[model samples]
Target chain A: MATPRPSGSGKRPTITEVARRAGVSTGTVSRHLNGGHWVSPDSAKAIARAIRETGYVANSTARRLRTGRSGTVAFVIDEPPASFFEDPTFESLVIEVGQALAARDQSMVLLLAGDEDSAKRAENFLLTSGVDGAVTASAQPQHHLFERIQAAGIPLVNVGSPAGLEDRVAFVAADDREGARMMARHLLERGARRLAVIAGPAHTPGGSLRPEAFADAVRDAGRTGGAGGTGAADGPEGADGSVAEGAAARIVTVRHGDYSERSGEDCAAEILAEHPDVEAIFAANDRMARGAIAALRAAGRAVPEDVLVGGFDDSAGAVAEDPPLTTVRQDFRRIAVELVDALGKQIDGGVRANVVVPVQLVVRDSTSPARP
Target chain B: MATPRPSGSGKRPTITEVARRAGVSTGTVSRHLNGGHWVSPDSAKAIARAIRETGYVANSTARRLRTGRSGTVAFVIDEPPASFFEDPTFESLVIEVGQALAARDQSMVLLLAGDEDSAKRAENFLLTSGVDGAVTASAQPQHHLFERIQAAGIPLVNVGSPAGLEDRVAFVAADDREGARMMARHLLERGARRLAVIAGPAHTPGGSLRPEAFADAVRDAGRTGGAGGTGAADGPEGADGSVAEGAAARIVTVRHGDYSERSGEDCAAEILAEHPDVEAIFAANDRMARGAIAALRAAGRAVPEDVLVGGFDDSAGAVAEDPPLTTVRQDFRRIAVELVDALGKQIDGGVRANVVVPVQLVVRDSTSPARP
Candidate 1:
């Protein structure tokens, strides 16, 4: 065997130096740095020792240039710019995802595709910007952004369940359905007979999944005799028969909102006007719940006294509410970790399935003394 | 000039094709694409025509590889992650900055350096990552992150005025001092004889400048006969001799907080406890103003009725308050635009000075009925 010789002096060692010290070609050293695939254990050990001895630090950017990978991922938000700031959940998710990416020596670029113009711009940037992959959040099922991303062949991971492209993309989502069921069961067990729901936009997965799951729980609890659930009553046939049956005994009205405080307040006002004896209100998210609380106070109803309000996404606002909020907690940190991991797998040419994180219900002053 | 020639058929045109048709070298074509500083106008026009004719599209990533420009900027936040979500001003700045960067076809990567470990990580990443530049927000004057960023030779533009580094770094900030003066004049003119200030952290530029300006306004108004202002009275050495002259007439007390709602509430409660007859309270920011409102309400004081409250930053919470906040609006959008522009200039090897955007006072329900 030829004795390994130092290639250069007074400069940082490159892959060529490591290869020369390891008695192998630079390609072998490059492959070793890129996960050591196809290299024998003996060669891998020699290369590792050579790297350690020669102080050869691999430049990730140079490696990316060689492999056509940017080592950067885009965290695309499919909401308006204002919503990016207004929603605490989005903030938490973005921070967690950025931190996670940072830990893996990767960078995350934030892209907002709120409207058609922005969507087109974001799509073009992603297609040609040399980003290795993407993690998207808040995309509606029918939004063409997903189709464009898919067509561009970029590795993708969704923060929430993708509506129609379930098979084509990987996702990580909190179990909104199970969380709604838990909220319903808790409320019902606390003797909340008359309930009202401030649902999110019908086009969103959380909007439909949360309300539908709550209705299912109510039906399973025998509160609404034969109404089946909102899912059944909302069918295209306009089936009012089951809804009429449950209309008299227990008032379970669902009003839709855009998951904003003002929208929640408006929906709550409408619900209160129509159903005067509503004992409990479930807002799809915390901001909406806060608005519901405000509306109740405006109408001379005290939270957890005359009415109990529950929220989802136990955000900072949840604790800051007057009576504090009884809400469901989605582990955003875990979801972010899973999202980065899934995207990493996809970047490595592996397919990943959907990941569902569990949710927990937190009881606070808003729903502690649920009255009959 | 050489006759223009068509290149390959049924394939993407390369730089060679454009160079051939333009009757120039490939180096000239690359230089033109990278911004034709040295190329003649006639040659530039020829290259442009050739590029259009040959449909030659430069690959941004490959160009970046050759030039070592990533076309990415990091928007770093020195505050904790929770603060990023809690403070509306931070959110607005971030959103506006992202939009401005998007317009320039640049990507923004958010980096949170709240803790020591994270700050170290951020410094390391910025030092090694191929990011073109950085725009940092919410960095305290004493934080060593600025030193590291400067030593690493990264072009930086701060969203707010940096203290000691003001001379060395470019920044964009609202006129906090002028805004505070306006608030003081407005309050004094409305007959708020007994005033209190909820000052921001003493170490920060806004913290020091806002309170000092308010004190200067009071001195200029001659409201506190010879006390100079809060800055003089609050300094060490018991300056009580001067304070005593104004203590019996116009009581102005200063309490400091970390620009948080909870801190504002605590400071306001302390102020109220010490001076029950205070007619006006000015919190450093909107969240603190909201907290002051809450504290007043808890003490059975109605805003603008029992006491008047004013805030800074005219954030989302200002309008959302029960009695809308009368506050100073720092035009975050303009500041973001200026920051991005400054960073771009710096990236082009141009030096820029600190930029100060103007502020406006928004009169609303909180202070319209200012009490005597």
Candidate 2:
């Protein structure tokens, strides 16, 4: 690949020097450093010995400089910094992705661009800095950030479907709609005919899909109620809670929260005031579900005895409570591993990939059969 | 200042070109970009205009390459990754430090060097990679990671005192000893004397200092009892619960946990078994306090009614409890701000500094006086 020279005179060693000492071509030496796919075991051994004897660390530095790549990937969390850490999903993603990158001998840098100025600066850094790729979590729906990253010729992967850019950007997602549907069906199967749902904000990927998916599951379960209400309405409005005399499960109401425990508590309180006979509740995330449990307790109703509570994201809170929460657990470890793989493929092979990791429903005592 | 050329061909502009366009020294333009400490407003405006007119963006890249500094800092967490996130303190530090770095136009990369292999790779990366500085959290009591960083001329700041290296390395810590002392006094004044302490691992900075401080305070409060037992012995062993009949107050026992709720539950259950007459507990952190409360509840000892519980770190679980936990609150925001400031100072001025942020005692119902 290059002109070879005899071992240098007491100077810094080069790849060529190692190649000469190893009795192999520079390409073979290079291949060994880049994981020796074709080099024979003997050649690999020779290359290793030559590198050690020569104290050679220049290949990593020179290759990076020649290509202007930093050997680092950015893990972008575009949500508010404080709020992002409050959700265990994001933290788990960070840990998993960090571990995966470490295993591949790559480094992951975290970029929290929650503020607009920070976001703008981050975009500039990605465009001009030496980072080879980026993976984004909690990417907003209608932002130009993704487009800018795409236009800059940087390989980008999103944790969830990026709204309108679903087909364009590679993503790995947990099926939120399917998870919500499972929770709704579980509650119904447990003899819950009057149901209430506490969904996340309507603008987010899960917020937009989870509540409606739950209502649809209820309807599909043979609910014979008034026309289904709008996602925004309360009680018999957006979701018809009033059903025919002998009808099956029906959505009594649907409320929205900001994916926080406090918001869930408030929403649950309002739902209780409106639908006293509501038999079960499904919260979009574990935090909100915990809030709903607090509200129910305040109303003197025992969990799984008077009302069954279900949550999503099987976070720490789900297990911290007595009679642990029944929730959907997104396989974040798999998602994280897949995210790293997808980005690496895009960087090395120019292949764009989308992966959807399945979710699991964890049943706990929160939805245990009510005491007779 | 170097000799500057007049504007010539319509090619990419340089710092010299910008200086010529602005009719100022090249140093003045450089100074303006580095905060314009001595540059006049007129010169700054002229430099800005010249940058716009010349389309100058090479200043950032050239300055970086010329100095061989990446202008990036690493936030190093030396604890096990999964366990690190379970504690809110570490998450808060990450958020605060990230925000602080953003304000100064510096990027903070997270380095989760938990596993041995990952830790070695991280050390190599820090030594060879272009990161300017690093701030570490949850650093084990015994490790050479800091020494190596210092030896390689990399600026390192520990979130807490680095054990025996306190005099040699820069650190920012909350007042763990004073915080523990305050909690001891609070419990003593609350009328209950038979107390227990759930401390963190004895090897950590806080773990070593807190419980011993509490025990020392108890002894100083003029306890009339058998020579206080060792920290390792329960009840009459390490701490004498059998006070000379009618003593002012005495430590019933001291137990150590790994600062986890589950550990707290295990320790508390064991304490209750060995020292059933224990009237109060001071858990080193909120998670442990919650665990202690859980154990107490399981044993039919109502919190505050039968046994008072105090926790350090006013974490989320503190408020989530029905009787919100009364605990110590570390000023993490202040610590984080100070951490960034210290590292930046070290990087820019080569001045190592150790700073300590204060802590506060938040009185919640967990430590409330027994209701009549």
Candidate 3:
């Protein structure tokens, strides 16, 4: 039986050795490993085997010397499959953050923590990967990754509220609940009495707070003196679709989506089925709102005439859509600026807890006055 | 400064000493220097001062041990501002490539090389930064950064065909000319005449080859070929738009764009003004095609009912548009796969050359019979 070689023994195998063993030149070895070019399958397998057998590691030190800064950051997120970059709100935010980090001579290393495996991978990457720091973004409160990040001594700046780990972490977030209230007020000001909501997943902060706040605003505006179970509703009181909030305040129907276009369409179809008389629809995010518009159009409803539509996260597509969408702008760039700033402070040993970035209502043609 | 101390002569300036000098804790010093979190303005200045005074240079060895990979693949593009990620065809391709790299445990470092200043910055980053390799996407051949990247000894891959350096460097590209020719032939077989082209920028290979091959195909079809010139002409041939081979070929009119939506809109508008009787429109890319559709719609023209439209690059938006687009689908993923394979080989000491991925036409609802 062959004895296993002692760890770290002998001269560290050079890249050239692997090249020679694979019957290829050093350039082939470099190109193959770097993944910018291709090698034959036979040679590729041979190269992989040689790398493992010879315990060969590229002189990453020499490589780093050429470049001044280590170019890696933990990109943390917890979302459903295909929903990672598909959600217009998260997509715009991530892209903006990516642009910001790239400008500052940093690279966004994606650490997808959508599941247990991904979370574990993220934790390990955070601890061992040569990332300068981490910019963590999550719709849900991923306490596990947050705690691990803090424990690993990796400077973490959450893109949204850190929830249970708020005291320990630095974060940049939008006032989602406040933005929802603002949207509700706009609809009311426009005299949209028959309101409905297309909410996001209940687990996410954006999904939970936006609908809740909108309901609160509606109830407060009506001043019907608190009906049965009105204050204890899951999302918003009006969203329950029951005369639960009393007949004085037109009850709003609610349907939930996982922040997906298809879900938005399905939810919109359901809402319309239940409440065909609904005059206004406010989706939790822009993608869903866009879907609602499509569904409304499909159902032979004229936007802002028979049915006004609004969404959150003023994504690029929202502005470009047929009628232009009325949505809330989450100020992603500001969040990015604040997160970087907070991370810098935390890195310097100052604890600045939970910071909030402002959001605003952006009304476009998708919304208009309710039918007289 | 009173007595210029020899750098590194005293006790190696540990982070602890720097923190003490800065009047902050070691954790704060770590965060400030690493740029992970925001430090308060005053504390950050103090840490900066301590770092400068101590002449502390974070060694590359420690960094290498932490990050298994060197850093990032510096990504450079020579497109315009809005064209960066707004053009669906190019943007989708870029995103696909980025995703591929991420899957392989690599991070992409963006180097915006749009202007001379940004070009210089890109050159400097590639030369001095910690990127293990660099990838140039849709870059113009004359850019300073493109030249610098070629000279840099690090591993390099060009995403598209870079005109002058094609033979000397490795690249992954789509078969643009072949695809264009295929589309032109398909249109002719469907009995279409009076064709107009919305061409992309002439400086790049994708833009240049597509129109050139398309014209060649029209001439080969034995139609009177008159559409081969760069400037506008009354008729492609002498009197009637006829093929040089007497096969009845005629270049209706050609308009140029920088491959952006606005540029596409302008070009399409110009083409329509020149030839309202045109039966078919072939846009070099999907973005231009979408713009052409919008222009056509605004002019009260019906698609496939009045004018047939064909576009390149089967992007997601292309399929999702009002009328699903008929397009030439460039095999971007296959090119990415090949690029990765080739890069792995080249890194391991293999010779590399230019590679071209195939493209195919996807027939959809956009194209129809010419208005009789």
Candidate 4:
């Protein structure tokens, strides 16, 4: 952990000292230090010795004044600090972004702006542009940090949907609606004729977008969702598939959780009590899905056997579950690449743009193909 | 995140221009910008307007030149970027450290020096004293990053045992030896004597220190560990406890893992194969402990019913296990506080020193007392 951290001090040796000790002009010392360009070999050696003897570490501020680039980027988390550990989505994005930045020979400075005060501090640092650009993950629209970042005017990339300011700020988002639709279709293909869902908080885009998209797909299959409807098969899906007549899957019930595992468990227990015959369950995020799976196990139901389960965000928890989750995978790697690329382009005078990364459906044991 | 990332422009307005526009000396303009000290009200107003008209954002580098302080600290991770998400200890420390620094109105710059190139970049940063100090976590002895930081000569605080350089750098470490000893004693008190251990990598301090301490404590109980002999108990613990005279525990086998859940499972599986009669297993870290629990369950060896399980590091994974883990808890909050506090002292001309934070054993269902 003892990495050399660049810093500043009051009584540091000046370049004048190095020039004096080397018996060369200050201009020669500056040139030699910058790149040894135009400096004789003997002068370079003397300057090196003088630098070592004077303990003359070049001042970072002075260096920046000459080069005008800090060679760093800040990865800001715009939530309470608790989310940094609690939410696996942030974790995935962080690791990806850090590695990508490192691949470009850049350091990623992680800043937690979970509160207004911390946001102010972050604003102070970012306003100085000590870092080249910023990438914000898990930030909500109209967040104060947003306006502050806009004020700083550095190249910015938002990981999720940026509600507004579409033309002003660059954003990279997963196709949440499309992913949810794919999950719903997969559930139906597994012969799940009755369904339940644990959606995210209503205030979030995922909260509204995913369940709505899922219900829309179910409806497109000639199924009615939200309010329970057991009788049906009038949907178009029976046209080409093996679905029996009037066997269109129905959304028997729906509940909302705060995207936490405990919330998922609570919502699942409620759905089980209210819609006991529900054939399959879907959660907007993997955390809630894992919780739902645990609840089902505790209630004596076997996943993919007695009750099928599916989740979104194929995060770390998705694989850890006993019956690995059949979840939608957000393209975090692509997002990171796009974010860094977008920043580079913006720095190179390119226009700010939006990119919607596709989501993928990964079928695992949690939602096995054959349903009882 | 379209944050206001302060950046330098190719044609940024100069202070001399501002001074000329304000009809004042450049020194007067500087005074007005710094604090408005010794500047008349009219001159101050003119300077402010001129700055706005010029669209000048103060250069961070120039500001640093004036202040001689960056008001930031580096939290160096001496491993690859992958560990940022995989290892919960680092996660916990990051959150705690970031919050602590926020409380002090100082920014924490996260830098990864997992390889030689990244290490070089990190050294370049710290050498300039861009940050006031550095705090490194999860580092090993003789790491190249260490010597680089020393060459930089800024205040530093290593978050674990520094291995060498005791006189040069300050450090704060958890009492790993005492914590391991406590876990061994707890398992014995819970009436299990046939113990097995899943230790960390041999190259790490935790890898060697914890197992040795646990073995020492077992010996204090008059028990032999590592390469088992289960015939009899010649231990003194029977004198004061419920254990029968011949029931002292022995470590049937010991295995190593890379502190990964997968590795933990592998080690536990190997131990289970060689020591089927073992009553308990202890892992050097929480991740490994969680993996061991999973393996034990997979083998139909019920936790605390057929075999008790113990793990070091009461991390997030500890609680997520079905039978929540009983493990050692390192006080990351205290460590963070001490790190920041120590840096403050060092910056204020205080002597470097070491501090060992005590560890505590958190009892939970995994190592429940009525062991079979």
Best by lDDT: 4
Candidate 1 C-alpha lDDT tens digits along B9-78: 4344577877998899999977665434466656766776776465342233233434545556788888
Rank the models by TM-score, top first: 4, 2, 1, 3
Alpha-carbon error at B107 in model 4, in Å? 2.8
Top candidate on DockQ is: 4
Predictions: Cα RMSD each: 10.9, 9.5, 12.5, 7.8
Q: Per-residue CA lDDT of candidate 4, range A1-372, in tens?
A: 122223234444567877898899999977654433477757756765666566554334344544555567788887776777788888778778877877776667777777756665665566543466788765655445666665555668888776555576678888988999998887776667788889987645467778989988888765344222333232322212334344556788889998889999999999998887777899999999999998988888778777879999889755675888999999888888888888766655646878888999999988873422
User: Cα deviation of A119 in candidate 2 (Å)?
Assistant: 2.2
Ranking by DockQ: 4, 2, 1, 3
Residues A78-126, candidate 3: write the lDDT tens digits: 5533465455565666667766665664545444456543444454444
DockQ of each: 0.10, 0.13, 0.05, 0.23
- Fraction of true contacts kept, per model? 0.09, 0.11, 0.01, 0.25
Encode model 4's per-residue lDDT on B113-138: one tens digit a residue.
Answer: 77765665676556543567789876
- Residue A86, model 2: lDDT of 76
Candidate 3 scores an iRMS of: 12.0
